[model samples]
Target: MNGASALEVIEAHDGTIDLMVTDVIMPEMDGPTLAKEVLKTNPSLPIIFVSGYTEDRFKDEIGDNAHFLPKPFTLQLLAEKVKEVLS
Candidate 1:
């Protein structure tokens, strides 16, 4: 989903959001910016950022609750990262 729509869903949800996996580059808003907005309401929410770009570019912007998954990653790698973050 797009950033705005995702934000709406996030805000409307009554239950917990275990994780948010968003693309680093999106049409409506960048992933970091979206994460910042989401964190305002859900500070402890886990986030896994997926991007084709280098991780160094956005490393400083994310918190310990976040993880970076570079593009071309296998489904196994993504699952591992998600499990790692959720754990």
Candidate 2:
């Protein structure tokens, strides 16, 4: 889903969401920006950011609660990342 819809879902869930997986670059809002906004209310929320770019570029932007998963990742890799972040 897009960033705006993701934001709405998170709001609708009232901070019950365990984690969020999003793309680094999106049409309306970027993942880091979305994460930053979400963190305002759900500071502890874990986020996984997916993109084709290098992880280093987003490391500082994403801060502690977020992880980077480059594009072309497998379902297994995505699962592993979710598990790792949720842990």
Candidate 3:
């Protein structure tokens, strides 16, 4: 889903959100911006950013709880990263 919809879902849900996986480039809002907003409410939430852009481009913008997954990654890699972050 797009950032706005994702934000809405986060706001509406009462259950815990284990992780947030978002693309760096998205319509309406970028992933980093979305992460910042999400953190305001869920500061401890973990985020995984998947993007075609180089990691250096946005690495500093996201905090320690966030991970960057460069695009063209395999599903296995994604799963592993998620597991790593959640662990």
The candidate scoring highest on TM-score is 3
**What's the lDDT of the predicted structure labeled candidate 1?**
0.87
lDDT score, candidate 2, position 81: 90
Better of 2 and 3 by lDDT: 3
TM-score of each: 0.89, 0.87, 0.91
| Candidate 3 or 1, higher TM-score | 3
**Higher-scoring candidate on TM-score, 2 or 3:** 3
Clash number for every model? 0, 0, 0
Per-residue alpha-carbon lDDT of candidate 1 for residues 1-87, written as tens digits (9 for 90 to 100): 788888888889999888999998887877888999999988888899999988888787765557899998999999999999888
Per-residue lDDT tens digits of candidate 2, residues 1-87?
A: 778888887788843788888898887878888998998998888888999999887788888656888889999999999899887
- The list of candidate 3 runs beyond 4 A from truth reads none
- The numbered model that scores best in lDDT is 3
Candidate 2 has an lDDT of: 0.84
Local distance difference test scores for all models: 0.87, 0.84, 0.88
TM-score of candidate 3 against the unseen true structure: 0.91
